[model samples]
Target: MKTRTSKTIGVAASAAAIALSVPLAVTAYAQPSDSDAPAAEIPDPQGPECGAFKEALPNWKGLADLPVSAALASIPEISTFNSAISGGMNPAVNITSVLDNGPYVVFAPTNEAFAELPPEQAAYLRTDAAGLTNLVYYHAFLGLLGPDDVKGQRPTQEGTEVEVTGKGGDIQVNATAKVTCGGIQAQNARIYIVDQVLDPAEAPAPITPTSTSATTSVTPTTTAPATTTAAPTATTEPAPAEAGAAEAPAG
Candidate 1:
C-alpha cells in the first residue's frame, strides 16, 4: 500500500504553533454492501480524529460533540460530499439525520472524488434518494473505527465486505483507494476522507492475511520428505523502504 496524504483541510498547517492546552495525536475501513460493525468504545475527548488543528473549531466543544452531518459541513474540500448528503434528492429521506445518529465510520469522498464518477452515474446517484442513500451507506461502516482500529476484511452494511490493509497511517480500502485525510470525527462516528468512491460491486476480492502456519512449518521435527527440500524465503521479508511508513511522522 502507499502512504496516506492528509487531504483534510488544514492538515498541513502549523498545528504546533496553535498551542492548544490539550495535545492530540493523529491516526488512521469500508464496504459496498452497507457496513455494520459494532460501535467501538474509543473515548471521544481525544481521538485520532484530532489529526490537525482547526482554529475555527469551537473552544468548548470537540468534534465528538457534533453529529456527522455537521462535521461534513465543516470541511471545505469535501463540500461536494456535504452537498450530496444534504441533497440526497428525496425530501422524504434524511441522509443528514441518519449520519447525525451514527456511530458509523464514513469513508467520505472529496469533491474531486465525486467528479471522477461517470457523468451518468453521478447524475443518477444525486437524483435518486434510494440510490444515493445506498451509495452513502455502502461507504460507511457501522460503529466507530479509526485508522488504528481498521484491519483485514470487514463486512459492510450495503450487502458485502470490504478489504482493509495497512497499519498506522498507510491504510488502503479494497487495496487501492487511499485515505487522503483520516480520522475526522462526529459525535457518533469517524471519517476517513478517501480519494476514490468505493463500490461493493467493483471491489476486489477480500485479502487473506498471511497465515502464521507458513512461517512455522519449519518447526515440525518429523523428517518428512518435504522438509528435505530447501526453500528460499528471500522474498517474504519487508523491503527496506517500507520499514516505517506512517501517516507522515508528526511533523
Candidate 2:
C-alpha cells in the first residue's frame, strides 16, 4: 500500500513540471530581439525649385511629415547655416528655432539683405552673437500664415508692427518693399523669398517721455501786466477844482 501511494505522487509531480515547461518554451519562441524591432518614422522635406539655390541644400525627402526643426536640419543648407552667420544673416537658424511651436509665415530675405546693410553693421552681425540672433529673430513670425493669409497688420519678430499689402490678386509680405518669391511650405514654417532684404533698424523708435527736471526748465516765464490808458483819469472836470479853490472867496 505504501509503495503504490508513493508512485502515484511522483507521476502527478512529473505531469505538472511538463506542463510548466511547455508554456515556458512557447513564451521564449514568441519573444523578439530589440535589434529586430521596427524602425522609427522620419519626415520628408519638399519645396519649390529655384535654380542652383534649391539644389545646393540637401533634399529633405520626408520633411512635410516631420517636426519643423527636424525638417530644417535635414536640409543641406542647414549644415551651412553657421557659415551663413556672416553679415548677421542667420535667418535659417532663427526660423528653425521658432518653428517648433509655429506655423510661421516668414518673409525670408535673400542673402542680399545682409549684404545690403552697411559694412560695419554686417560685420557686427556676423561676429556679434547677440546681434546676429536678434537680427534673425526680427524676421520670423509666430503664425503659420501663407501667402494668402497675409492681411491687415502683423508685428515683426522684433516686435515692430508692419502693414501687409498684396499685388495682382496675390498676397505679399511687405514692410516697405515687396517680397519676391511667394511661398515655400515647411512642416510648420511657410517660408517666402524676398528680393529686398529687411532692415530692423529702419523701424521708427517709440517716443520717450521728457524728464520732470527738463519740463521744469522749459516752463514759460510770467509776462508783464498790461496797462490801459486810465480813460482820461476822469476825463474833464478837474476844471472846477481851481474855481472851488476857496470857500473863503464865496464868503
What is residue 195's positional error in candidate 1, in angstroms?
0.4
Model 1 score (lDDT): 0.66
Candidate 1 structure quality by residue, lDDT tens digits, 86-120: 86444544578777767787877877888899999
lDDT of 2 at 122: 68
Off by over 4 Å in 2: 1-63, 69-95, 167-172, 204-251
Q: CA lDDT, every prediction?
A: 0.66, 0.53
TM-score of each: 0.56, 0.47
lDDT of 2 by residue, 138-186 (tens): 6666676555655545556666644556632344444465665444556
